[model samples]
Target: MIKFNMAPTARKLVNEVMAVKPGERALIVTDSGRSPTITEALAQAVAGAGAELAIVHMSPRLMGGIDPPPHVSAAIHASDVVFLQLSYATFHTDTIRGALAGGTRTLEMWGFEEEMMVVGGANVDHAEMESISLKLTERLTRAKRGRMTTPEGSDISFSLDGREGFALLQTAHGPGEHCACPGGEATICPVRGSASGVLVSPFCIEHKDLGQISAPMRIEVKAGLAVSASGSPEGERFWAILDEAGELAKNVAEFAFGTNGACRKRVTVREAKKAMGTCHMAFGDSQSLAGEVNTPLHVDMIYDRPTVWLDDEMVMKDGNILI
Candidate 1:
C-alpha cells in the first residue's frame, strides 16, 4: 500500500498527462503486482474527467514479451485510450500493436513506484520536456552519421543515414500514440551492419539497485551486433539474457539520451534512465524503431558523461546537449 497522498497526482495523470477529454472511454490495465491504492485513485480521476472508465486486473505475465489474455485484448481495442499501470508492461506485445493499429492511444506507466507517481520526473512540466525532446530529435533526424565517446573508455561509431529520431513526449494528442509519463528521450536506430567499436558501461541498468557502479562492464560491437561482454556479474547476466534470446537479440537497437531534467536516482532504473546528462544503448527488438532486428527482449544499458557527434558536428559533450 502506498503511504502518500497520490490522489492529486493521479488526477493530474488522468487529466493532464493522459489528456482524457469528455465522453472518451479510458481503460486502466493492471496486473496483480500493481498497487490498488494508485489504481483506485486513477479510477476516481477518470470518472471526474467525464470519461467512461473500466478497470481490469489480470494475472501477471510469465515473461516480459508475452501477450495479455484475450478479454484484456478486447478491452484494449474497445477503448479510445488506455493507461497501462502494470508491473510488467504491455507495450511490446502484439495486443498493444494491434490496438495502436486500430487508432487507440496508450500510456505505458510500467513499474512506477508510489512516490514517483506524485513527484520527481513524473510530475515535470510535460510541455517543456516535449519541446526539449523535439528540438534534439530534429537535430538527430537531420544527421546522416554519428559518433560517441566517453572519458571512461567508450568509443562507438554508427550510421544514421535515412533514419529518423523518435521521442516519447508524454502526451497522446494523436492516433496510435504511445508515451511514458516520465518520458523525455530522443532516440535513433543505427543502420544495420554499420556500427562498430567498444562501449565501456560504467553503470548498468540491471545493476542500478546497487546505486553505483561496482565493477565496470565492457561490450564489444561488430557489424551492429554485440559480439561479447566482459567484467562484473551484472555484465555476465546482461550477456546471458541476450544470448538466451538468440541471434537477433545481439543487434544494436537504439542510441538515445535522456532529457528529463526533473528525474533523479531511485530504487530502480526507471527514473535514472530518464535523468538528464545520461545516455543509454538498447539491444534487441528494433523493428518498431525502423531497424531490421526483431527479438522478444529489449534491454537498455546506461552510462554517464557521453560525448556525441553527428558527423563532424558535436551535438552533446560530456552528457550535456550542446545544440
Candidate 2:
C-alpha cells in the first residue's frame, strides 16, 4: 500500500483557508477517475477540523456541465461546504447551481491530483493571492479595452466594456460565494463578438489533458469567433475540439491573468492558470463570467511571456504584472 503524506497545505485548506468549523457538513464529490489518495487526505483534514465529512462518488462526466447522479446533487445542496474532487468538472451543471442557490459554499478542485495536494500552488498564501487578484480585478474592471501581444506572434484585442472581472480566491466565507482551490486569478468575459486577431498559445489545457505547444499554434479570432487555427499539428486537435463543441465553441469565452505568486509553469492547468504573469484564453461558456455566450465546454489555452496593454497602459510585460 502506498502511504501518501498529507502536506501542511492540505491542513491549511481545511482549517485556516476554508475554516471548516465543527458541525459543518463538508461533502466531497468525486468520481472513479479521481485519485483516492487525494480524497483520503481531504477526508482526513475534514475529520481533523471537526467537520462532519460525507463523500459522494459518481462516474466521471464526458463533458463539463453534465449533471451528477441525483443523490450526489442532493448531498451537495444539504452540505455546508461542497468540495468537487472530480476528473472532469460538473461546475456548469444545474446540480451545482442548485447547491449555490441553497447557499452551499463550494470549492471546485477539478482535475486535481494527489501530487497537487502535496505541493505547487496549493501551499500558497491564499489571502495574499486574493489580495493580488482583487487588485488585478480592479485594474481590469477599470479598463474598457485590452490588447495582448507576444514575441512569438500573438496579437489579440477585445473590449472589456461593461464587463466585470472577478477574483478566484481560495477562501469562500459567505453564502452564494464559491471558489476553486489552488486559486489565484482575475477573469473576465469580453463583450460578444468583440474579440479579434491571432492568439499564439504557449500551452493548452483541454479537458483532462495538458500539453505544451511544441510548435507555433495560433488561433485566429474574428469578431470573437475562432474561425481557424494554424501553424502546428496541435492546431488540428484544437480545431477539432472546438468544432466538436458545436457553433458556440467558436465564441471567445474568457480572458484571465494568473495571480498566484507561488505557482509555476507546466503543472496542472488549475495551477498554471493562476501562475502569476501568465494568462489564459478560454473558449466556450461565457455565462459564468457574466457574458452571454454559453456552451457546454470551457477550454483554456495558456500563454507564457505575455505583454498586455489595457487601453494604452501596459499592465503585463513579458510575463510580469505591472500594477
Candidate 3:
C-alpha cells in the first residue's frame, strides 16, 4: 500500500492546467509506480469539478514491459474524457492519438511529482499520458498547418486535417475503430496523414545521461509517425538503449508537448520532458495504445521548440501552441 501527506491546494488541476470542464467523466489512469500524494489530491479535484471519475491502475511489474492492463481499452471508450499520468503507459501512443481523434477527448498531464510530504508509490506521467490528446486534436476541427521553432532554430510543422482525414483513416485503416492497439487498427496503429498530424519535442537520452544531453536532438514526423530521428552522442545513446528492446525499437514511441514551465532536461526523463515550453517523442508500443509494442521498450526525446506546419498551415512557432 502507498500513502502521502495531503497538500492543500486547488483540487481541479484539470481546470488549471488543461481546463477540464463539467459534463466530462474523466478516466483517471495511474499505477503502483505513481505518486500516491498526487493521486489522492487529484481524486479530490475530480469530484470537485462536478464530473465523474474512473480510475485505472496499470500493473506495477508491467511498467517497463510492452503489455498494458486490458481495462484501459473499455474505459477509454466508455468515458467522455480521460486523464493519464503514467510514464510507461504513455508509450501506448495509439490509445492517446486514436482516442482523441475518435471523439474521446483527454487532458494531458505529465511529469508531476508530490510536493509537501509526498511519498513515491508509483510513477504517473500525466503529461506523457494525456497531453497528446490536446496536441493532436486541437486542430482537428479546423485543422490548419503552421511552423514552430526549436530552441536550436530548427523549424517543424504540426496540425490536423479537416473532418475528412479523420474519417478516411479511421474507416480505411486496417484496424478501423480498433486502431489504438494490435488487435486491429483499433488495437495497434500506424501513421495515417491528413494535415500533418503528430508533433514531437527535441530532447535527447543517452547512456547513463538520460538526465542531460551532450548532443542536440532533431526529430521529424508526418501524419502520425516519426520519419526521422537525430541527436549527437546523446541521440545515439538514446537509441542504443531503445535498440535493446528488440521489436519495440521499431516503433517511434512518443509524441508529446511540454507544460512544465520550470523543467529542462538534464539527467532524469521526468524533469527534461516536464520542462515547460517543449515536447518529446518516443518510438515503441505506445502503452497509451499499444503499437509496435511487443516488448516493453520505449524511449522519449525532448527538443526546445520547432516550427510546425500542419496541413500547410502554421499552429506552433518557436515551441508555442498557436491554438
In the order shown, what is each candidate's alpha-carbon RMSD?
2.5, 2.2, 9.9
Predicted candidate 3 versus true structure: per-residue lDDT over 141-214, tens digit per residue: 34443344555645444332222111111011111122110000001122323113333334544123454555
Best model number under TM-score: 2
Clashes of each: 0, 0, 92
Instruction: Specify the poorest-scoring 10-residue window by lDDT in model 3.
Output: 179-188
Model 3 has an lDDT value of 0.46
**Residues 218-299 of candidate 1: C-alpha lDDT, one tens digit per residue:** 8899999999987877667677877887988888888888899898855457777777788888777776677776667666
Which sequence of candidate numbers ranks them by TM-score, best first? 2, 1, 3
Alpha-carbon TM-score of each model against the true structure? 0.91, 0.92, 0.49
What residue runs in model 2 are displaced by over 4 Å at the alpha carbon?
1-4, 62-71
Error of 2 at 82 (Å): 0.7
Candidate 2 residue 117 Cα shift, in angstroms, is 1.9
- Cα miss at 246, model 3 (Å)? 4.6
